[model samples]
Target: MFKKNKRISLLNYWTSRYLLTLFVGLAIISFISAAWIRHTTFQNRLEMMEFLADETVYRLTDTSGQNIGPMGSIPGFIGNRDRFTMREIDPILYVVDTEGNIVSSNRPAPPGSAKNVANLLDGEEGTKKITVTNEGQESVQYVVKKKLENNNKVVGWVLVLEKKENLTRVNQAYGQLALLIGALAVLGWCAIYSLSKRLAHPIKQVAEAAKQVQEGNYTFDLPQNNKEEEIYELVTSFKEMANKLEQLEKTRTELLAGVTHELKTPVTSISGLLQAVKDGVVRGQDASEFIQMALVETTKMKTMVGDLLAFNQFAVDAIPVKVENINVNQLIRDAVAQWEVMQDDETVKIQMDFLVKSVDVQADVVRTQQIVTNLLTNAKQAMQGGIVTITLMEKEDAVLINVSDTGRGIAQEEQAFIFERFYRGENKKYAVRGLGLGLSLSKMMAQSIGGDLRLIDSNSSGTCFEITLKKATTL
Candidate 1:
């Protein structure tokens, strides 16, 4: 079996990685800085020694090669056995003649120190490293030399010798640098930790909110006000989504009840009427009337069932549409005339306005007629008596057919959901019995035929819906 990798919180994830990177970077910097500090310190010490050698030669001799005083009487000179503890380094000095003889000295030289004088040519002056073994222990030393001259001719040499052990003590500066680097690393880690926590806090809250939503609890507290722009947008968008899902959940429950009630009503009525006739509770004429009523209920039930099936088919794009070019003006007029004959109320008037005499569009004739008939029915039902107008206009490769009605218009809030499946408006939910699929189905049909249906305007004055159809290329 393969093991699943464990998940970690965002805070830990970011902080851990940042901490590792910070330390690695600091370590590399410290190493380079330490090496540079040690090298510079050694170079500075060598330069100081060279300066001392030059000064000693100047003080010990005049322009002509001759000693002004004994080396022990010179200022800043220490005896061979004198021990000084206040200075960082104490180098031994020796004055040697051009014949390689020791002329004056500050301290007795260690063994093998005089070998460097013999290696020097007549007036040569420079610094060199030499390893000297004293009392069975090996140690390195720096030897700096300056030429002693009389009238520009070489007379002797002044040498300053410093042990390598003394120069290695320069690491104290490296230690201080390491301390500063350590402090900065601590500060950096603290800043990174705090920032990671701030970023992870809001994300955790969102995750918790999502979990609650998954468990069907849509109401929960979230970090509403965030300073970060992206975090603010995420929280805001998630809140909106949760609210929409809640509304959909509530609508789903209501639709289920409505469907049950709508389907059961006719079934109950038919069953009761048939039982009454079978039990012979009325005479021949009464029996005929009850049977007619049962048949009417049966027909109503069948129509509702058919609407549900057709809607399901259309939703999945399973229904085929036949598209053809037809005269849009004539189509609307014919559809309105046929719908008018079926209405029981004569007070409801439908007025047609055509901007053009003849305009052809590519659309399914039956579906187009069905959309018009549905709009007329909704407009007529919206009020007791009102004018329902159908306006036709042509604009840039398309035809627009607007159906408007002067009714108690739709409620401002309810207007947004008119075309949602099984969504009945509050005003019509109880007064009118329907599954609320008329507009929804009509929209689906319109889109199926390379057309579209949308609400243009609605208020207390009236409501208008527009249907857009593709215009035929020719005739």
Candidate 2:
């Protein structure tokens, strides 16, 4: 037979946990309240008994060592029904002499009650409860005895007896009250469980979405129209995280395809050129030119591979830079000069517009040089014979360098993703064949040195890349 298994939800779990603690706490309070009520009733009964016994002593004798009427007449006045009625059950009274002889009695004395009184008269005052059974019904009675004195000398005794049923009735009342409180507690727990269900509803949605996410599902809905701020924020954050993860997955797929295609072209070129030279199909001068071409392609491949490795390090924050104060203008000039020397096409003119003769900045010299080299190379490669302007100036508390090229600008749609890893724009003139990590890596390098690199402007006229570095403090 197939059996149904019940699933315990978040609400059930929280309810059980909360109610367990509440049950224990309320049980303790009920126990303490019951105990205190019983104790107070017992104390009140004992005090009343003592008060009645004292009144009897006063009525029996005056201060001049003389009886009011006779010794036997004491009980008649002490046991009078009109005088005291603090308890529903009346107490039994007995008057005795100092030598343990009974002088007056309210009722026929039971042997146990008399023995206890005799013990009390004979200096035995420690005993508190005395059990008396009458007509096959057993009951507990509190014993209270007071010394009767005249002229500060012991004359006789007055013993008062009250039943324990009065305190028992009080205890029964408290028990009823405790039952009512327990009912209220049950209602309160029900309310709490309902509230917990409401609270766990949104949380449950998020948990289910996350489970789906673990299984490679990133598309889901989280309603945020009408909800508490905290809950809204939680749902919003989870949605944003899912979107980011989806985008990252797409980027990874693109990178794999792009990297493969980029690497294959140069490798295929070099292989074809070498194969041609090896087979002796090409002559000496042409073979030498083919070899040079292969070398250039290999160099391009090396540069792409290096960029990939450096980007990986930058992603993990593992690339360390030696930070120091350096002359910004000189660094830019040196990078441009080196780039110009590497270029075979002298048709591309390089122009410098230095608004400041010397601009100092805090940066890692080598990495800063790398950033400048990337920009210069990008500008040179983007154009066939146009001017590449390198402008350096001071902007408030920072040094700014703008690299502009008179080539086809990056597409408006692709502008947002230009600095994204493995992202390539479709600008035909500016589309250099390589892994698109240079701008991303350059941006990371700039940020690592407490500086920034960004696309200032890119239009049909030209494209401009700006670099900002904090000014070095003068000692």
Candidate 3:
């Protein structure tokens, strides 16, 4: 079993981390933008108030034809005038002369603003300026001052009182908006968490499956994910690998049992025969025959062990093929000829059908011969006495060699598993004398040489097995 990590899982960590970053960034931006809007509204309000006051003073002086002086009732003229039409920030106008006495007033100043006015009059101030005065908890006011000058000498001042109502309204609206955005951010955090969990679900399943596999539980099923290509591929590949492992484990168990049976039969026979001879259970000639039979059994056991080793070599890719272009037709002919000399069944007839002569393919000569020999042997063993036919032909970009037998065909249920190692069918009436490794070994060798071996047809008539090899273009 794999050691579990003690830290937080990736899903939780990233979900919380990213959501925090998102809301924090939104908060910072909102703060800056709201502050900027309030400040901008305040400045613009001051400018508008200054413009209105200047315009009013200009009209009074123009109407009087330069006769209006600082002593005149300026407040009466200005107060009787209609109100200005500015919306963003409304203001009250206050005017004072060089002696600091109020010259005119459109509206009374908010308390505590008179000191600000006096400070302005006492200084050698510039012609135009704006300042802020806080009236404790009652209100805030922005003051715009315009110095009225006659030939650069201070005559009086135009004071504009722009209250903070518009600015305050804008800030209140921004506060509400901020609340709404914060609410959305909370909802977004939930969404992010769900998305992270959805993404992590499949990964967690795979991890659990892997742990089960490590504990030798190959039957565990992994959840499938078809939408994500990379994840799907990973899951499919792991399934295939697990299936292979399961099959190999089963084959190993069967191999051990089959090997034990095969070895024990021969060893027991030899041991019994030798014991019988030593006990004088047979005469000298019979004893000699028993000894010869024992030698044959030993030889057969040796061959079985050798076959097991060869199959193991194929499994481990230890058998290197020296590949070269060769005439496949000639190879098949030579293999058939060798089998013909070895067959002692007089009732069996062999036929050869070569559709295209001189067909060439890239193959290892020895492994190719071995493949043909194994197939022919299997065909011959399938029947007590029947016809075995070898056919060779060319396919598009490939070559095909089929070995067919005229005998009782392999069972339909067993065809799929015929090439699996040690997979013996129940049909034991004409069982051949060997472990069921010949077909499996032949199939592996064919694949090693970039070829394939498969049952083309199997029925009451016969069974035909086809071999496909890569065609050599150079030849």
Candidate 4:
């Protein structure tokens, strides 16, 4: 398998290449091997003939004036003459003399053969060559020879006829071995390529899955039935991760749907209630009730519109920042003062613990207050009949704040999507007077000012929203 950064790569280029290389390599090897074997056999046979040539030269000298062994009678005159032949290896061997007197007894012809070495007994020695026949009736050629000499003196000449049939057998054997080796090499190459392709198959699956995901098809299923358990494990983990992301996406879309319906409810209600009041269908105190209902609906509309607009503003590329240093404790107190005025809370309690003295941070004051205000409002809504705790602290290089609510805690599955725009929990409804953009906008705003907002902890102990900001630089 091939991979980069632990992700499988899709490329595979070895399949065709290995097969071709194997074929070429085998062909070259076989060609070399065949040539070597043939050369070795030819050299061994030729060496044996050369050794026999030395013995034949000795016999020509030792026999002196008469013929003996494989040679015919030596001549004392000079001119062209016929030679004698005997069957030895294949076609036969020839013996020609200085004067070319080929004796019948020295070079014996096959039984009942017509030639008796009679015409070859006396002929020319200065003619430089000689010829002999094996089956004279059939005119079958036996051997031909030219004069050979070592120095100024003339030495005997040799002519050995080779059968065409023996050569054909050697050629056939070499060809067969070469073909067999070639076949084996082809089969081996096929096996290697098949193995490489099979091993690389898992990578193909991973690549395909990635492509499907890119195309917005998140429901891709990995091949778990693969024999390699490690690949199966990798695919299983990928599927699980993708499924979780898909579910979180679905939740966010659901939240957006809820926000849209929430806005529509208020706009529709206000349009109806105000229309009745304006038309005088309700009079005096009844008219006032209708107006109040319309007011309540208008307030809900304002909250939804505000949250959405604020979230969108952070997402834009426009730069409208005006950063400055300010005491975070004072900043929170001022924000809480506005929230306190919005709702009278004699029945409920709100508290601020300024643990740090003069905790300062560098920020765009308006956006920083928006973040603090959003967290405070969210806590306030949750703790309708309970207590809300807000804290500000100064660390070494940053200021931190935490807001805690004694109301309903966030669910585990919903926590991951909490900072995504328009993502709300399952328990949330269109009547909640929130567009689900507050936390999302707050997180984005904090990040823009070199800060972050995150859930510190959430459970039955209540949810905590933690904020971190860079400590304000001292002059």
Angstrom error of the Cα, residue 417, model 4: value is: 0.8
TM-score of each: 0.67, 0.63, 0.60, 0.55
Give the deviation of candidate 2 from the true structure as CA RMSD.
Answer: 7.8
Off by over 4 Å in 3: 1-7, 13-177, 199-206, 209-213, 216-247, 274-280, 284-292, 314-320, 346-357, 379-433, 447-468, 473-475
Task: List runs of model 4 lying over 4 Å from the truth.
Answer: 1-11, 14-202, 211-217, 223-241, 248-259, 346-348
Candidate that scores best on lDDT: 1
lDDT (Cα atoms) of all candidates against the true structure? 0.83, 0.79, 0.76, 0.65
**Which one wins by TM-score: 1 or 3?**
1
Worst 10 residues of 2 by lDDT: 70-79
What are the per-residue Cα lDDT tens digits for candidate 2 across 1-475?
9898887988988999889888888888888877877788778778778887877777777646675553445444454545655544477777887777777666667766555566656554322687766656788877778877656677777888777876445846686878877896899799889888878999999999999898989988878863678888999999978876676677778777788888888999999999999999897899999999999999989988988899999999998888888888777778788878878778778899876567678988888878988887777766767898988889888988888999777777667777878766665313567777889999999999999999999887779999988898889
The positional error of residue 20 in candidate 1, measured at the CA in angstroms, is 2.8
lDDT of 1 by residue, 203-260 (tens): 8999999999999999999977799999999999998888777867777989889999
Residue pairs whose backbone atoms clash in candidate 2: none
The backbone clash count of each candidate, in order, is 0, 0, 0, 5
Candidate 1 positional error at 348, Å = 7.3
State candidate 2's TM-score.
0.63
The full ranking of all candidates by lDDT, starting with the best, is 1, 2, 3, 4
